[model samples]
Target: MRSAAADRGAVHRPPCRADAGPDDLETDVEEIQNSVYWHDTEPVEVGEPLDGDASCDICIVGGGYTGLWAAHFLAEAEPSARIRVLESHTVGSGASTANGGFVGLTAGKVLRRLLWYYGREKAAGVYRTGARSIIDIGRFCRRYDIDADFAMNGMLQVVTDRKQLARLELQVKRSERTGLRGSFKLMGRDEAQERIGSPQVLGALRTTGALVNPHRLVQGLARVVRGQGVDIHEHTPAVDVRRVGNGYRVSTPTGTVTANEVVLATNAWQHSFGQTHTKVMPVWNYLMVTEPLTDAQLDRVNWPGREGVSNSLSFAHAARLTSDNRVVWSGGRWYYFDGRDTGRGHIRNAAAFRDLRESFARFFPAWDDVRFSHAFGGPIGWSRTFIPQFGRLADGVVYGHGYTGNGLAPSHTGGKILRDLVLRRETEYTELAFVTVNQPTFAKGAIGDTGAHLFVWRQETGDRLPLMLPHQAALAPRAFFAGRAARKARAADTGR
Candidate 1:
């Protein structure tokens, strides 16, 4: 088997940074294409679109991880059942190929919210499930001979300032109380810096997370699914879905699929349907990849474990090394258009790319000369509760989505949940906290747009507040998040 990192070679280097203006930064990326680095790693054979009417036992709408995983599991469970996956573009062309490829465990704000809503046992169940998903993905890759650069090297949730440090301390205490003491190891400033050579890292919480080449993972999974007799159609967008007798009819641009069961696995695009319009909010995230680092450049960072690193802020930044040694830097501010627009037009935002470049320079000043080779953006589904939700929408229609930003590993759990729901089984997956009947939805129209803007402002502002200020200066935003969690928990309990 070929190693995922051994194939790629370096490109031309750009001018080094020296307090350069925005124009100079623009020059650095001027020649770079707005494309995902993962997609360019290898060539993919695109499948044919649906040409006419079709029928299947199970129809999955979305060829990303969720849908592909669901098909894989369903095929394993019921070999006689016919499964089909519909994709708007190519498989894994959206967030799956564009995200920072950290197969993460639930942590930071997401874990906090899970603990608040569900008690310790339930929250721990979710964590355990997430952890198992990571292992399961590795096993699946090995079983299918998919060389996705699967490395279970773990991840570090670092604090850049004193305020974040305080918050990380509290989070550690909470995790300890929740019986997850062994899941994370707290590291002081020096120890944290040893793992990751960054002066900004005040403290770190190390968790058992893994990383993978997401494009290879998804594409390999699609091939496995197709080999298992599942039909996958690329460039076949589901235009509409409606109830037809005992089944559901999914209309696509060129054909229609009538199936006994339907799975709405279109992560960010789930908002396009009425049943999920308010249930999911589509937010755009941007990422940039640098040219492959030289041995000396890698030695400067001294990231021997090559663990994925992300900060502990509401609008956090995450960095990880690709299989080919390029640094993938992502996350600063999430963008939401005035309307819920998930079009190609929003994929390349100049402002977001500039912010990403500047933030990367700040975090790893040792790599001041490293130039970015690729920049791209994609939409991710953000639930109001900040966790993924999957259950039946109607009798024959089951959906799984709202992964927020971390879906690679959990989507494995989601596939099992979806499989059980479609089979009407009362298994452990069906009892998971996020698998529910009536999940909460965000506000609609102008209210939702305004609220999303305000939420982003609060998160970014909280992260940007000076450490010299009093601790109380950051209390307002913290309180806001806490209050919202409480309200969401209450609403979920009351089925509102």
Candidate 2:
């Protein structure tokens, strides 16, 4: 087995304050600087890279959730078949563990957007698939005894500014109309504060989004799959994959893997594959975690449930409590790596870190005395549509990637979809919207890059613009209300 630490290179710390003494808040910030909270908790153990020539019944690339889950299911379905997973870095190195640990559905408005693309039945089916994925993941954790700190403590999508109130309210209405499980409910200001105690919160939409120690979850999944007779190789990057006769030949620096079937489970790095290059964008997102709050400090927040919390901004701000009582903050700002460069060096964004710090202070003024312990970033595969792209790229070549940032639950469901595709079996999983639908590929070259930049720019600018123009403060809410009313009127008129 290879040491996972070798791939991590050097540790990058946050900006230090020269004026501060050893006894001040600067120490807290430096404590967890430039490392993932989950990975820092435990040492990751991974196997050696693929050496020489190898052959398998199924070859899966990338050791993150997508590849691990696919291998787990495939090994179960065909016990006699040979299974191998090749990862470029250590297991859980990508978005799998480097995320905000949000186990949520890609439903909400994305469900409604599906209605526009597909019909009502298909849209509802798509929404239900994602909703059920949340349940399926929790059940798997319990059944396998993977103690990843699985918490079904629910999540709160709060609106900090008045401009966001209508949007939050509309989501509640949409969830009700879409017949989502009885989990999503509109909360008044007082109720929202009781749940999260953030002064910026005006209202919230509460739903059963689980929180987990993502690092533990992925590590556990890898362990379980390996126990079931799956071979996993770390520090092995699949440099080239080409069709050879009835199977595909995957070349790596250390060796070559020829398999009857190949599944590309690489997420953000999917762009490196010619078949998926234009189909996904490898963009980076940032996160920061605070030092463990004191018992007295925890009381000031009043969140006994310790639910996951995120605001309703387009470039939304999200925060969740860890088992150790530290708050992990992410979003509010994201960046695009011009040429799909997901090198480890690109993971540190000083600007994104500063923005996250300022936003955290604004949202939780009561925590002024508190300082962050860690700050880090990771790449997320963004499809043209903010949903995942799933299907068979060619015979025996199935691919799953691009969950935007909501990969935890979706990846579990996607894994099953890949299994069905690999086995050439038609089941409910094969008919789901994400698997059956054709996702539009992003424009290649400068056009696609420019569009991606502008999309991110619009969200960042929109969130900050209101502060500059007090006169336009009420416009967003009014516009949202007007749109909601129009949708309601159309539904009533149709009487369907």
Candidate 3:
């Protein structure tokens, strides 16, 4: 078995970068870490990891949704399986706790392109799974009686410019062809304003997405998983993982656990480990919440609806109201995403704190001067492909990461699928286009970062172009072509 000390040396060599900043991790847990939707829930208490050599049929390296779900499933799959979870920190401390509490079945770049390049049947399967994922999540929450403010008022893919209208229309057409089960519509600026309470909208595609209490969900899952008799340990970092005999041995600071199967759900932190760090470049994002606006304020704008809205910009803008009368809206990323929170509470920039306020007024003029109660910012993890990943490594070891900043419902879905993959169980959802199990690998150097940043930046910028350029539609395939050449040449240059 790999010793804990040896594993630590293999991965992160301290001082572990004193530069690890709050931009990478949000600051002050006293502030609003998650939105007001989860304001009422209690926090989960910390637990200890195994202190002696132990054995389990399955051992999960993360305590987030993925690990919790794995434990939940293992209890059923092999009731006798000695299942244990070793978290680097408290359960849900990673992206599971840090995510902006937005959960929908929206798939990203590859999925969208697959529809355009591969046609409907394949794409339909992907879309159908996404639609069903929403149902699956709801079922889990209901079955477990998880109170994460799991609301299904739906999501609005709103647009702010006429040029983007064509792109949105194309997506609408693709949605129709896929025969995905959900109601979707094209709302013009005026119609959208009526529903969104934002006049800045030029168009919108409103569908059944959801607004959630992310931390609450995380805590709830952790609770129920423990209740199911899963052995969970917090503040227990998996210092090393190596194949041992037919299974794996996970070494922590205080002890070790040998298991038949191991799962890693550490997200961007996985990069600290030799392989995943380079493949999954860490990115940062910022979010702000307003003090509860009065019911009188909400009624004037006609935005009392429980729905949530996201714009078509490259960097998305999402807004939803809290039961407490606050509206949490967000947009933009950090300038240098070395996983730092360089831009927090610099109210002077206004981009982070004020942009959403502007959006609220443009969409719903009734919410003026409703001051921001709090602002919290943190790093969000993404993979090179911009698709969330799921796979096994070194025989019985498996892990999932790269939610690309969208990890609400997907977390639940990923956990269920991941557990099934670990146990080799037959699940009806297994037929979905799950993320490929390519082992942890990195893109070539600054070339990789440059290419990634460019595409992300380009998409981020172009998404807003439709708002500014009324006559020309934004194109993704063209962006792909441009990025493909640069990425390949750069990859070769760096030997990636």
Candidate 4:
């Protein structure tokens, strides 16, 4: 099992704290509706709810990858278990579908951090669980006859700067110390250039990973669970859940569901629940797909092959070639920490876009001038600790969230883990690191926005300090977080 932590590191080192580009544009809902990810083509289309109150053995919320996969695993574990899924929107509508289809396996420095915080045994356990989850995803696709273009192509961690090169050097050594799958193999600048077919590439640290069309994959999983006789209700949002004896009573707008257990798969939408917890909001992650390159331009990138790759530069980016011959890429920087929209949650501002255009032209001069076919942007969630926060929110209520920017395939793994938790299965998934409790203080919309803006600004745009410089940088915010959590704890004790 690979570590699921690759994309789940802390709010990225080069945090997002720049001024908002002066513009306000409505997101293209039509683009979202007409996406290749979700088209109405399922064998048993349960687009509507059961029409009234219903009872199931388990009720799952949110139809994104997490909820759907949870339903699949539950049916697999118990063929006769009565499972019902409730989704707020159409399937694959959220981050599950729109993310850059990179199933990141080489959990960058996540393993390194785990070894530092917890002992080797505990950290290794989580890594094993996470790695196996990736393997499980591939296996499940084949088992369920999913054709979301599952590619076993690994990822290349591009190294651009000498400082970044040194970071990779330390990362490689750290991985070895923490028992990485293979030796940290470093490719030279020329070697990286030749291997990735990009002349601008200096060096690379490649690792075993995968690239899957995330939306297609989740849609396929949704189909498989229906084949198993589980009931799924799309456009159904589970708004509230209260413990009823040994089970729960979940409420929706027009109906309610009584279940012995409930799984909360709504990562970004969890705050809608009237619970006092640290929540992740919509942080628009802007993405764009270039038109398929011409033969002459293709030769410049020579992408050798279509594989997922992200570099270590500040506000670095990740890219992959789609089956349609389009290049899909994502920018690596966030704007706020308190979960507010920063310039509509953009990856590239005008200045940044100009530089990005230059970089593209620099790497693949042919692509430099190619116009984008479509641009998509939305939010991805993250917890304070960076890794996913998954566990029982209460008795008979288990949920997971906070993948940050790099969820892709790892969220699938979390799906499996949450399934095991629901079924009480004692597999290797048990030993993995889980953060069930990170009590957070309450902040109104105004205060939350203000604090988040100020903190992120100081961490990112402020030249006085760096966001991630060992212990020196985190001292202030960590203390702030502790204070917030303590305040939350006190409030919970009194109010609840």
Best by lDDT: 1
lDDT of 4 by residue, 372-443 (tens): 444455566655555666777645588777776667666766777788888877765644665433434336
Best of the two (1, 3) by lDDT: 1
Report, for every candidate in turn, its global Cα lDDT versus the true structure.
0.84, 0.80, 0.63, 0.63
Model 2 clash pairs are 32-373, 32-374
For candidate 1, write residues 1-496 as lDDT tens digits.
1222235544534522424468776675556567677877777899999999999999999999999999999999999999999999999998888798999986578778777777777777888899999999999999999999999999999888768866776687678767887687767667788999987877688898999999999999999999999999999999899999988899998999999999999989898887778888899999888777778888888588899999988788999998778888899899998788898877778789889888887888888777676778989899888889998875557998988999998899999999999999999899887785347889889999998889888888878886654443134534533543465478568985
| Candidate 1 local distance difference test against the native | 0.84
Model 2 Cα lDDT, one tens digit per residue, 89-143: 8998999988999888673557656766776676667667777888888898999
Q: Give TM-scores for every candidate, taking all chains together and pairing residue i with residue i.
A: 0.90, 0.88, 0.79, 0.78
The TM-score measured for candidate 4 stands at 0.78
Error of 3 at 62 (Å): 1.1
**Cα misplacement distance, residue 289 of candidate 4 (Å):** 0.1
Each model's Cα RMSD: 7.2, 5.7, 12.3, 12.5
Clashes of each: 0, 2, 13, 9
TM-score of 1: 0.90
Which parts of model 4 have CA positions greater than 4 angstroms off? 1-46, 181-184, 279-282, 336-363, 435-447, 454-496
On TM-score, the leading prediction is: 1
- Model 1 residue 179 lDDT score: 85
Q: How far is candidate 1 from the true structure (C-alpha RMSD, Å)?
A: 7.2
